[model samples]
Target: MVLEVVGVSPEEESVYRLLVTSGRATAEDLAQRAGLPAADAARILDSLALKGLASHTDGTPRLFRAAPPDVALLPRLKRSADTLELARLEATRLIQAYQDTMRRHDAGQLLEVITGAEALRQHLRQIQTCAQDEMLWFCKAQYVAMPSGSNAEEFEALARGVRYRVLYEKAFFDDEGAVDNVVAGVRAGEVARAVPHLPLRLAIADRSVAVFPLVAGGPHGSPEEPTTALVRDSNLLAALIALFERYWEDAVPLRVDGSDALSGTDGSGPAEALSPTDRKLLSLLVAGVADKAIASQMGLSRRTVQRRIQAMMERAGAETRMQLAWHAAGHAWL
Candidate 1:
């Protein structure tokens, strides 16, 4: 029974065990001990010998001896385990390929409508957890199924080296803790950008599948439940990916980490090196976020925000905010 997994049937094992107990046995002897027919015993013994579980001496009416179980069965079990592992890997590859092919041919498999907030949240989590290479996200204002700063999955994915490119609409920063969340993600290696507005909220994983809202406007508590679509490999998914890239090209990068923010600073650094705090402030400023909003997001008073801007202006030798923006760009400080 223990050797069955290594291709030893119960009958073969019984014949082999009998041979081992006898030290040496002919087919007739093993058949009598195993209570099997002589012909069946001979066949089983041959099967065990072929599997290296038994061997025969060179003589008439050959005496079959069970190979040392530790030496023979261990290797067979190891080989069986190795073969099973390879088969499992191949099966996974084939299943993925088959699903992709099906999605391409069947319209019904291309798009799945997910209704209700709970369902949408589950799909988002699943996609991020399954993402292998990269994840692209369009974050907009107003909470839907998942609110800003609550997607713990992104942090987990990032930790495992899944590159995340997230574009946030300007209004997204207005949400409480949004900027803090973005800073956390950037520090963890997420590439974040900002735009004045986004067409929709979307998330794509590995460029193979996408999820987007089916209804406009986020959760407003007006009894209008949110709906979303899970899109597989298709033309629509391609178009969505293209749209994200188009917007990404024009978006402004957010620099939260001091080292990374200054990594690209061009020739002749600022009069004084920009601290991490200053770099963060500068990033939001370049993104066209107002001082008041920046103050709120950065947990600073508006006066302090203006004071810091003035200080940066003096350091850049810029007379006005516009010139400071230009200086930041020329220096690659953003």
Candidate 2:
């Protein structure tokens, strides 16, 4: 009833209740009963007195008491509270209106080009800072190599409790230093992984923003010179996430052996083993690349690539490329 009339909080109400129940009490006495410190109780009492709901007698050690039940200030205090609440709500609405207008003006749609390594770093920093839930990335190990005086900012972000997931090629296992850096993040419970072979670098933040390089040549491009597309549209982010899921499904968990090595034991190996070339071919097929492209990249003719893929699929006892990718990934074959 007091809060409805005078806009006091529960803590203040407790202090008032203590004074009323005690008839008259010192600040120290009220503090002990209300489970607050003497200083806090004194402040509450001062606020109540200023609102004319309570007062302290000017005697030795000072004693606080609630105002008389029939005090004429009750209605006046209610009126003052109502007026203050109205002003607060009006100011809140005005601030919200300004924020909505700014959002309308700044909302972006099309993909923006981000060129050069320094620019990429800045863009990544923005995503890291803005992330509230999760960050998913597919990157080459080389892209994350720290330069002189450059901190492992990405690792630091993960350490601060950002959920991170990364997909990278199997070659990352060979770079122990790079692998260790990523493993530190994993130990922090900030990361999950998919491995063996990831394509172009892709990053999505909080399911609201995405970044990926427009690989003109191939995956081995210079980190300091790659071109990127930075997208902020929800639809585009969804598409990118879907793509990541597909790749993640076909990638290996980074943990190998009992240790954190790339080739560590996740569980059982494939029912059937495959050569490195077979693994490579399977990855290419699952990615939806044409036979010609696979042939060109692998230095083989279309017919030879097709024959090899056919043999591997049959050996794995799989029918479709999708099934092949699924079983192979499950068994850690590719």
User: In order, what lDDT does every prediction score?
Assistant: 0.83, 0.69
lDDT of 2 by residue, 6-104 (tens): 567778777877777899989999989888988999999998888777888898789888887457356767688789899999999999777656645
Check candidate 2 and list the clashing pairs: 256-263, 256-264, 256-265, 257-264, 257-265
Clashes of 2: 5
Residue runs of model 2 more than 4 Å from their true location after superposition: 1-110, 144-151, 174-176, 215-224, 256-260, 264-334
Candidate 1, residue 8: CA error in Å?
3.5
Angstrom error of the Cα, residue 53, model 1: value is 3.7
Candidate 1 deviant stretches above 4 angstroms:
2-7, 17-43, 50-52, 59-61, 68-106, 116-118, 129-133, 156-163, 187-189, 222-225, 249-253, 257-334
Model 1 earns a TM-score of 0.62
Tens-digit lDDT track of model 1 for 35-120: 88989888988888888888998898998888898998788889999999999999999998998888778877999999888898
